[model samples]
Target: MSRWLPWAVGLVAAVLALGPALGPGYVLRYDMVFVPDLSLPTVLRGADGFPRAIPSDAVVAALSWVLPGDAVQSAALAAVFVVGAAGAARLMPSPAAAVVAGAAYVWNPFVAERLLLGQWAMLLGYAGLPWVVGAARGPLAGVVRSLIPAAVGGFSSVVLTALTAGPVALWGRGGLRRGGLLAGALVVVSLPWLVPALTAGAAGATTDPAGVEAFAPRADTPLGTAGSLFLLGGVWNAHAVPAGYGDPVAVALRLALCLAAVAGWAWWLYRDRPGFGPGLTAAAVLGFGVALLGATEPGRGVLAWLIGLWPGFGPLRDGQLYVAPLALVQALGLGAAALWLSRPAGGTADGPGDGGAGAAGRGAGEPGSSAEPGPAGPGGRRAHGVGRIAGVAAAAGLAVLPVVALPGLLWGAQGALAPAEYPRDWLAAQAAVAADDRPGAVLVLPWSAYRGIDWSGGPAVVLDPATRLFDRRTVWNDDLVVGTPDGGTVVVRGEDGLAREAAAVLGPDPRTGLPESLDAAGLAALGVRYVAVSAPVDNRFWSDVDGFSVVVEGPEMTLLEVLAGPINTEEADISGLEVTCGLVTVGAIIWSVARSGSSLGFQRTGVERRPGARKEIP
Candidate 1:
């Protein structure tokens, strides 16, 4: 069971990593997508528009687009697992000790979260940095290959912002000068996009306040401020993302496992070479950071100082990303501790050169110490020490107990998957819209209904009644943009004249209703011809409208031909509303999902409830 345990955990982990791409969460946004480039519909759909930040999941998306999700996630995960194991083995002081470290990491919740929740940026950083660290201390050939890591770190920066830059800049034992020079070069190169982004940012485009945004939040409040830092330190059981995100059970278990790992790591370091000093220094600094950040003024003084000093950190608002390095360091330390703990307490019974035993206790001063430093590198006849059993047990505890709590996770994933409880409506209304997208027609379909228009090159705007009238804020933008007035063939949807009413709010068509024919109007100028409405009555927005033409009717959705009136200033205003909505809706979904949930599981659970409702409500 112990031997198979690692493989079993790995297989399940791989599957969980594959879940996002294989399931509805990824595909659901295929329609209202935002790409990194401002040019809409040019490439992939993203939560943010044309931003340098790429979703870390894009790696998985690219892979899933080609092969199956399982293979892609597994391969990526395998690389992390293997590299992590190798690193531990090299440092564990013994081969068996290294094995124990491997078991601990593979089964840890930190690794589990990264794999399962699409934390590709962190994973990528882990993959690249270790290689860079090895290269920094290894041969010239390794340094030359370090370019691979440097380059990957550049892309990962786009995912996690400037956070990934830390490992690349400082992973090696090289002096600060060398690290500074390398980091400076990377920063200079990264500036093209960063510059434009800052320039764009300077324009002060307001970030769409989606979810429970604590905009202009009170950094002065002691309790809230303390809560933020507590959350950041991973000291008080931090959730994964957004606000209060993370499994409570996983949170508790994660904390316990993390503690175990850190303790074991300390033991390993001490066993390999006794030194309470460095570990004590690290603890002091961390505790200080926690204290300073938790003070009444979170944005000033020591909290600010910590952020500035936290190497490679850039301007970031959220405190969650700050905790990553500490987590990894703790894990590595734990692995080392496990190595030490695994060795026989009596002494180097294995032999003087044995690493496992060397790691377990300071023992008789071996040549590897300052006295010997061993026979140079891995080629040295170092003793292979026994692995730590407690570390293994702790890791095992995490993997198994989670299984015990699987029932809770089911509710979590299922709830997240079921956010919006809308009745299923398939292609019923889609049939009426032209199958092939025609270039010249000013086509208009009901909001959220894209039957025929080729979204391949253009974008879809929802012309729903609820959207046009009530509050006018959309996930896209807080306000709408009105369009130029030109009489276009109006295609009204459904039996209700509400589409007409929604149409009338803009201009000439407000009371008169959509005209019967439109020919001379330019596609963009005339707005949309043939509106589609779903409701049959003169609903809230449509009660004042004249009539509508139903092209198709079905049990599920209805399609109608709506003749919209001449484009006027009123229409232009509405178009701005679209832009506003697109800004809020398209740009902020990821921010919302990652940051807004009451609990970490809620992010996933809330997603299933009704994605639209979540945005709409707040």
Candidate 2:
């Protein structure tokens, strides 16, 4: 029962949080977009800039072949909560503590905001963090196996893993060797996107310095930016905050919970001296510092300078992402608090000064601690009974505290994340484009990267589905337009050179993504064979235009075929280098698993040191 409790809790949390989102169809919000029968070849071909969708989309496309795309989406989203809760829960010694940790880990503001932002891939890696920590002292195979979720999540996830687990691996039993192994594993798993990014030249990897200010973390609660971040809720996008999450009462309660959790962590660290404690503490501190960097002018300048120095440093622009490690620390700390609260009282045997024999006994040093309360003298038993009842009630309250403090995460984020089916016209447009063996790329019109579609019965902003709807390469506006709190917008320059050329030719209206007139000759010259107007727009510009033929026209989507002179129908293909790297990564993982003879899930909970070995915290 104890072993299965965490899994059960995780599943229940997922069900409660997701609600109608797990029913059917795709939950399209911000960056999260899913299309049926996604083309694997097209995903592998990728776009001009960083292959952000590479292996994640590629994996999704492959899975869509076997399962419905909606089902795949539901499973992926559900996995975030389930895996996260289970992993965090396993870190605790007792079932009650596990329940608290698991719930706290998955129900926090970080998870809520990221989920609302539709960054399910990043969440997938977030879910796997505890497993990575657990596997830090194990064999290389165990590390690789633990990183599967991160591999699927792509670059950001890999970076987060490095920030969170790098310290643990380096300071663990094998020291530098373990660190080297971790680095090797990260590189191998990152090949799909890493190879492309390296060979993409300077242009493909370029990032806008303007994005530094635009994506910086902001205060979401009455508590200032630092306080909000400490409570794990300072996401950059205001729209990503959960409904009713900023109520003053809720903020105060959450702040108190965070302070208590931090205190519990300190107590547990001093008492248990768990092997991972020092390293985890270092990681949490470093991550929190990074998160705070964006809240100040000097730190923002430094971050901007870093981005200017190298485009790879662009990830640092979103400082809220760095708070992920802090979230993990808080979850563990909450668990430790529950452990302390529920321990038998009235004697030193199960109290704070028991030489780490209470909750610490079941900590990382002893993974499978199952000690139960035993009877004492009659007077001691009476005291113990009262303490046990009170402790159990307190532990139960702690377990429910996260839910009470952040009530907005209940029931599909209060219906902000409901699923929506693709309109028939959109599906028809996809079919029309796929049926044709078009050699040229599909140009997504509106000349904007994101769309506020009403297909979901509500206005949900998402990256244009047309970008990945077809079975060929797509050219669309990649520029990000971020709205500031001061009622202004910041337009971050895009990285795709070809898209920039298209924008120049079209000269699209700044507000509306539509051009004054259609330029057929110019598009054909740029290797654009089909133009897909993904958003609802007036079709007056399409009329009497030579070299342009309307293929599919509807209120939602308009597909046009360009037949001006000779088209540069050259198509991009997955490079031999990319294919080789992908194969090598897969082969390496297989070899590592074969050599180890056991995977992460199958491995014992803790690493066994030599007999008579004195555990060192640092």
Best by TM-score: 2
Off by over 4 Å in 2: 201-204, 348-386, 592-618
- lDDT tens per residue, model 1, 482-601: 221242222212212223333344332323323323232332233343443333323333334444445555333344444334532122122333334334432333342334332111
Tens-place lDDT per residue, model 2, 407-499, is 999989999888988888889989988888758888998889997888874677889888888998888999999999899999888888889
lDDT of each: 0.34, 0.83
Q: After superposition, how far is residue 611 of candidate 1 from its true place, in Å?
A: 56
Candidate 1 TM-score over all chains jointly = 0.49
